[model samples]
Target: MAEAAGCPLSVIVPALDEAAGIAATLEPLQVWRERGAEVLVVDGGSGDGTPEAAAPGADRVLGGARGRAPQMNAGAAAAGGRVLLFLHADTRPPEDGDRALLTALEGGRHWGRFDVRLTGASRLTLLGLVGAMMNLRSRLTGIATGDQALFVTRAAFRAVGGFPEQPLMEDIALSRLLKKHCGRPACLRERALTSSRRWEDRGILRTIGLMWALRLRYWLGADPAVLAARYHRG
Candidate 1:
């Protein structure tokens, strides 16, 4: 499907202290540019030279407030495209993922995410299991996280008031809002590769348990700030 509107698509990446991973995250976009998409990287108080490393391939780089949500919103504000793709600094889309995203956007799926894969082979089985679970959940409930490389039309994003400027779970919050406004979400066939650093650090099962517990608490109407604090403390 091709967009009836002729405006370009913009891929926005929000980064923080991602010097080690930013280049890998951006390499796919360099190929996307050849297919006529714009790429923007928004840095949030990165002490490392992430901005510089990402600048060479990015169409524009903006420095912004130190939070992923705000940084993404800033990038969206600066974007000239009608379709906005919000990617994490540690995630990489597939080679033809931009085209696939455009197709989804044009097919009237205003907001959606790709399937996810964890990079590297260490503990690959465990990470793959988690990815399978997430895929199943997304297929059943249309809920996806940012690490899966979510995309939406600019109008849909603005209609949902953009991403909430929170310290944590901004992606989940935004996904909920999008589902409320858009009715149903969609998923691309291609998978986005995300770093397994967090799982590696916290242990996959332990982290998954903590995440489920936090989700249960949130569903029980726990305060976002409290949950964010707990996440930070962990």
Candidate 2:
């Protein structure tokens, strides 16, 4: 891991049709912004006012191609921070997340992700199990998903050539690259609270099964475009 003593941190969010949650998502990050960190929102051709809604909380809101990979890459390109944290519109990092990331980096980690907590209005007992399983799986596999709030130093990110511009599994793809080049990530115990709307709306067990199937297919060298289409259809 490269030394990142004085480089500022940047929180990069990729959004699309996220008007309802954009403000809430960026709100907590305002404290970090005030402390010299920058927050950038890259909108992926949102029909709703996601970009406008994000402007108040973000240092800059820019338009980009309609995909998480592209939008996030755009944000990274424009970001001024030496360390970049990629956050989803429906996720919120734990309090003092900036310090946590910086501390991890200073301890010699090039890239890492937080443990995730899935939350929703529904009373789903299995949600706890799901989150636990996710954390454990990431620890074992050295593969972190987008929901976990992935962060990496600028040098490491550029070395991996950023997230692969794939239709699906871009997070997984980037994780593999990073693990190959920079070694295993620092698995922070502090959780990033991620929305469980997908699981709740799509049925928790069904979503789990689908995810496993998708992952298996992806590992089997299936086309990401087809997998993405299948994911959206579900």
Candidate 3:
């Protein structure tokens, strides 16, 4: 596939049964494609035809084993850009996101993530607060989540040995490694809009508590396999 002119960013989206949102997720990426960005959708055995959904919008659609980490790694391996962006299927970047990424890299920022806004009709103040806290915590801790649309230069990604092949917390593991080796992330101000469907379906309070508890256990040396199971159960 031909890349858009002057842009060298390759967006990697890992998918597993994400058919519902894949098209919407890839639609906005068309603008980036116009500017030389390539979109690669790495689907992990999605029986729901996610690859078909993404194929029309994405530059390339590749199949892989069923796991986010591994699927992401596969995309990274096939990507032909100087930079890599790992985006969730339920997230969409800001209007000028391509420019923002190029500008950040031009300004010597190696790796970073966009702030995220939860989108939905839930007028729950808690959701807003949660987003605020997430942005703040990420800025303070220099950690970026998949929902935040994490981006890194190819060199930096290789230096960090890529995302870990874990079921849960791959984003966290990548963030920690990036901080240790590349310093704090750029923490872009422009926000990516992420679907609030998860919070809407699962009780918001319950989801937050569960996430925090999982992180605590992970930090305390819990096995990722166990954590993954817990996450599935939740």
Candidate 4:
């Protein structure tokens, strides 16, 4: 993989049992691959042929430890790029997102994330509000979530020791560490489209409440293992 400036970029997608949407998720990224970006799909022991489904679109399809943090770390370890972008299985990057990320780095930011728009069966109005609130919160707190498509330079990532190996809140943890090492994120205006199934499955308001509660507990020193179980149960 090679960029015009000799700075290679790698997009890492960590998935588990995502065979149903893996192809769609990787499709748009092919354009980036054409531009010398290496696209890697790290699967967490999916029994549904996710690896095979992902192999055609990705530069490398890797088997990794279960959980987003570990799987993403595995991808980072195997990536050959000077810059890394962590994308979720259900998220779609904006047009020219690869260039956007690289441009942000070129402008001297060490790490950044795109704003996100939720897409699914939910009403557009409510979803729009949720997406706006999320973007606003991230900008205010200088924290980027995985759904926002977080990107970082190799040096910054190494300085922060990568994402913490936790079951939940790994993105939040990584953001906090990155902020300390590299300052606030770029917080790009471009939006990545993330699935709204999380909110749609459980009423939108309920999902919001649950997420806030989980964060509050985590901040108060709750065990990530327990939070993970509660999140899954919901």
Instruction: Evaluate residue 109 in candidate 2 and report its C-alpha lDDT on the 0 to 100 scale.
Output: 90
Off by over 4 Å in 4: 1-7, 121-124
Cα lDDT listed for each candidate: 0.84, 0.93, 0.89, 0.92
Residue 134 CA error for candidate 3 (Å)? 0.5
RMSD of each: 3.0, 2.6, 2.2, 2.2
- Please give the range of 10 consecutive residues that has the lowest summed lDDT in model 3: 1-10
Q: What does candidate 2's lDDT look like per residue over 43-135, in tens digits?
A: 999998998899999999999999999999999998889899999999999989998998999998999999999995323569988998999
lDDT of 3 at 133: 84
Among residues 3 or more apart in sequence or in different chains, the pairs in candidate 3 whose N, CA or C atoms overlap within 3 Å are 4-36
Per-residue lDDT of candidate 3, residues 1-234 (tens digit): 233345489999999899988999888899889988989999999988898889999989999888999999999988888889999989998888878987898888789999999985333688887888889999999999999999998889989999999989999999999999998898899999998887878888998999999999998999999999998787
lDDT of 3 at 25: 89
Between candidates 1 and 3, the TM-score winner:
3
Backbone clash numbers for all candidates listed: 0, 0, 1, 0
Candidate 1: segments with Cα more than 4 A from true spot: 1-7, 121-124
Supply candidate 1's per-residue lDDT for 114. 93
Tens-place lDDT digits, model 4, residues 1-234: 233355379899999999999999999999998888999899999999899999999999998999999999999988889999999999999979999989989999999999999985333588888999899999999999999999999889988899999999999999999999889999999989999998988989999999999999998999999999999998
